[model samples]
Each structure stands twice: as C-alpha cells, then as structure tokens.
Target chain A: MSTTTLLLLLVLVGVLTYLYRYAMIGLFASRSLPAWLHALCRHIAPASFAALTASGLFVAGGEVVFAFDTPRPWAALAAVLVAWRTRNVLATIGAGMAALYLLKLLFPT
Target chain B: MVQIPTSAGGEFLAGCRDEAPLLLGVAPFGMIYGIAALAAGVPAWVAQLASAIVFAGAAQLVIVQMLAAGAGFIPIALTSGLLNLRHVLYSASMAEYVRHLPRRWRLLLAYVLTDEAYAVAVLRYQQRHAAAADHAEHTDSGTPAADATADLRHWYFLGAGFTLWAGWQLSTAAGLLFGATIPPEWELDFAVPLTFIALLTLLLRERAGQAAALVAGLGALAFAALPYKLGLVAAIVLGLAAGAWAVRRLGPVR
Candidate 1:
C-alpha cells in the first residue's frame, strides 16, 4: 500500500475504534445498566480474547493445522503453564518464545 | 453514588494507579506488536504512529498483518473495529460509574477506556457499591445515608494507562530500530501465539470461563479457512453464545 493510503486507512481504523469504544459511554451515560446486560458484558473480554488467541495459535497459511508435532501448540502450552503458575505476562511470553526456539533447534525439519 | 471532586492532575494520577498491574500484561504485548508490525512489512514510522494513533495492540497487529498480505482497506478497517468491539461493552459498564462526573472527566475517561482500566475500575466500582449497599441496609433501611467514597481506583487507572502508553510507544520504536537485527532462525514469531495462550489461561479462572475458552478455541480451529479473517469473528460469536448458554444452564457461581 502507498503511504497515503496506509495513513488514511490507519486514520479511519483509529476513528472507527474510538467510536466503537465511545458508543457505549455515550448511550449509557445517563442510566444504570440492567443486571442481565451487566452479566453479559462481563463475559465479553474473555470470550473475544479467547477467539483472537485461538485463531492466531492454530491457523497457518489459511488452513487449520493441529498436531502434537507442531511447535506452536507445545510453545503455547508452555506459555499457558508459566502464565498460570507465575501470573506474569512477560515470563510467559519469554518462556514460550524460548521453548519454541529450543524445539526448532532440537527437531529441525 | 457519592461524587468525589478531583482536579485534572488528581484524575490523571488516579488513572495511572488503576493501570499498574495491567501494564505488566500490556508491555510485552506491546513489544510483540512492535516486532510483528515490522515483520509484516509495516514501515517504521507507520508502526510507531500506530501505537500513538490507534493505541490498541491487537487491532494494530492484525491491521498491519492484513496490510502486508494485501488485504483491502475496508476489510482491514472492519476487522480492526470488530476486534475492538468489546471496548463498547467496557465503555457501557464504566459509564454508570463516571456518569455523574463532569463532562470533561467523563470524556477523558472515555478516551482511556482500555481493557485493563475497565476491568479494574468496574471491579472496584462493584465492590464499593456493594459495600455501600450493605452499609446502608444495616444502618438506615430507607434513607440514603452518608457514605465514605474512595477515589483511589481512578488513580490506579491513570498509572496503568500512562505506563502502557509509554511502554507501547517505546517498544514500537525499539522494534522498528532493532527488528531487522533479530534472526528469523530464532523463531521469535511463535511469541505472538504464546502470548495469546498465556492471556487465555489467565481468563480461564472459572469453570464457565474454561468452557467458553474451549468452545472458542475449537470453533476458531474448525473455521480457520474462512476468508477475510471471518474465522476470528465466528469464533467470538460462538464463544459468546457458548458462555451465555453455559451461564443459563449452570447458573451463576454459588
């Protein structure tokens, strides 16, 4: 993409994102949320984030690739374990990256 | 709701305080965004500007990747917007808490309505409001009695936001500057998926959450071939449906 097009696209995306965020605050500013809606909103982050993460983990070259031999699943498992045990994001990512690199080194195809 | 008068400086500090723990989670993610943006062929200036202008890590990463893959602008914009749709839910949740504040305060809070800030602020608000309700129930059944309101949560958010904002900008710059130096053989590319896995594990603290995560994971895998990144969107819808269904069937935690 040309610089101008990329810049314009970035600007449009940014404004749209801001609008998405501001839409709720604008609509609900003067009122309390219904209990049911509040309950539903509580699940939004986890569910959306899970989807984003899952797609990134398992998809490769426009296809689903799942197997024990793949480096990603094992690396992700290591990261999940570190995150669960330490509850630290940095350590989890670092460990995951390290594990993947080590696996690639040990079992090159 | 008790109103606490705070100066702009106080409000900014309050924002920082609420965001500290979340900054820990966000910083490395920002670093990953930096690296990925470069690897995806986004120019250095554009990548750095993304953190300042867009300021949403996942969306920025996805957008840059799509741009590199020759995706159309409209699809990129839509995907970015869709990835950030949860922010709307967060904004709505936080609106009631800050509604009575001045317009300026509300506007500032709205601009800084990030996932971490929203989570911490909402949790604090719920805890405080429940305490206030309990106190009022015990002391005077009908009357709205005087209540002690703590505004520390606002400071917490400021701490988190400023910290994250700074980290994002610097990390993106670092990635642009040093990304070429890093060897592809190192397989640092796996960091992206790993980071997500760690984040997902954190969210799976409850049985319902676990079930929702599993459903989303499987759904995304099954629908991975959908064009224009629709698989991610499908996974989100299915995950939300699964969670809502689970909640309806199982009821809330005892």
Candidate 2:
C-alpha cells in the first residue's frame, strides 16, 4: 500500500471505528434502555470473552486448526482449568505457558 | 447507592491499580502488533502511528495482514470495520453508566475504549453494584437505588483507558524498534488469549453465564467461515440468546 493509501486507510478505519464506539454512547445518553437490552448487556462480557478466547485458540489464519501436534489447545485447556480452579490471572497465564512449553517439548513440533 | 467512601481521585487510583496487572499481558500484545505491522511491510512511522490512529490491536493486525496480501484499500477498511463492530455492543452496554456525563467526556471515553479496558471497567461497575445491592439487603430496604458513584466512575474509566493507551503506544514502539530480535519460540502472543480466559473465568459465576460462554465459543467455530469477521458478532448474538434462554429456564437469581 502506498503511503497515501495507508494514511487514508488508517483515517477511514479510525473514524469508522470511533463512530461505532460512539453511536450508542452519544445517542443513547438521555434515553432509557429497555429491559431486554440491559439483560443482553449483562451477558456481553461472558459471551464476547468466550468467543474471543475460543477463536484465539482454535482459529488460525482464518481457518480452524485443532491438531494434536499444536500445543495451543492443550495449553489453553490447562489455562482454563487453572483459571476455573484458582481464579488467579498470574497463575492462569503461568500454567498456560508452562503447559505450552511442556507440550512443545513432548511433541517437538 | 450507600455512602460509599470514594472520591474521583480515589476511584481513578483504584482504576489504575485494577488495570495494572493486565498491562503485563497488554505490553507484550502491543509488541506483537508492532512487530507484525513491520513484518507486513507497513512503514515504521505508519506502524507506530497506527497504534494511536487505529488504536485497536485485532483490527490493526487485520489491516496489516490484508496489506501484506495486497488486498485493496476498500476491502481492508471494510474488514477492519467489521472486525471492530463488536465495540457497538460495548458502547450500548456502557451507555447507562456514563450517559449522564458531558458529551466531551463521553467522546473521550469512547475513543479510548477497548476490549481489555471494557472488561476491567465493567467488572468493577458490576462488583460495585453487587456490593450496593448487598448493603441494601442487609438494611432491609429491598430497593437498590441508582448508583451514587456514577459521578466519579468516569474518572476510573479514564484512568484505566489512559493507562492502557500509554502501554499500547510504548509497546508498539518497542516492537517496531526491537521486536524482530524477539523469537517466535517465546510465543508471547498467547498471553492475549490467556488474559481473555482469565476474564472469562471471572465472568462465569453462574450457569447462565456458562451457557452463554459455551454457545458463543461453539458458535464462533461454526461460523468461522463468515466473511468480514461477522462470525464473531453472530456468535456473540447466539451466546446472549442462549444466556437469556438459560436465565428464563432457570428462573431469576435472587
């Protein structure tokens, strides 16, 4: 991409994204939301976080990859288990990295 | 609700403190984006500025990937926009809390909003609401009034958002300067998902939450083929529906 194109791309995406973030915030400030929207909002964290986590673990380069040779799945499993059991962020990340290294050593691929 | 002892400055400090640990994951994630942007042949200056210009990790990465693939500008822009559409949901969710603030404050906060910041800030808000509810119950009022802390909560939001912003800029610069020296073996990028997992775990205190998460995860896989990354959006919708259904099936939580 040329510098002009790149700059334009950056500006366009940036402005569009800002609009999306600001739409509800700026427009709905004075209006009261319906009960159903509030209910959906309550679950936004769980649903979005879960989707992000799963896609991060399973999808690669726009394709789903779940191979035994890859350590990500196993490492993520360990992280989830650690997270569930301890609810400690550092512990969860530590367990994930440790499991990834261990699996990499065992699988060597 | 109650006479909670917290000022704007105190809440600001609290926000900074809460977001501090997540910066560990954020710094490396920013570095990864910087390195990836350079590797994709994005000019170093553009790459650095993109951190602020685009100000989104996933979307920036997507833009660079498409650039490297020689995709057209329109396609790249569209994909990035679609990928970031999730922020709409976040805006709506946060509308109630910060709505009463001035337009300038709302604009500023919206500009800095990101997935990490939203997760941390929302969790704080929810916890405070829960505590206020508990206090009301103990007093036998059975009525949780409007949040009294709303006045200073934006300070907390600002504190968290600005901290993340600074971390992202520095990390992106570091990656542009020295990221190549970092080896792929380190796998620092995995920290991003691990952080998400940690946040997900905290959000899953009930069966309805678990159902939402499960459906969202599975739905993302099923819809992975959707163009412009709309699959994530669809998955989230399905997840929320599943959660709402589960809530009705199980009845309300007292």
How big is the RMSD of model 2?
6.7
Clashes of each: 19, 0
DockQ of 2: 0.48
For residue A87, model 2's alpha carbon misses the true position, in angstroms, by 2.0
lDDT at position B151, candidate 2: 49
Superposition error at B195 for model 2 (Å): 3.2
* Model 1: residue B222 alpha-carbon error in angstroms: 2.2
TM-score of chain B of each: 0.71, 0.67
Give the per-residue lDDT digits (tens) of candidate 2, residues B156-254: 888888888888999999988885676767775566578678878988888888899999999878877766556666887789899999999998655
Q: Would you list the C-alpha lDDT of every candidate in the order shown?
A: 0.69, 0.77
What DockQ does each candidate score versus the true complex, computed on alpha carbons?
0.54, 0.48
* Predictions: Cα RMSD each: 5.0, 6.7
Off by over 4 Å in 1: A1-9, A24-27, A34-40, A67-70, B1-25, B62-79, B118-160
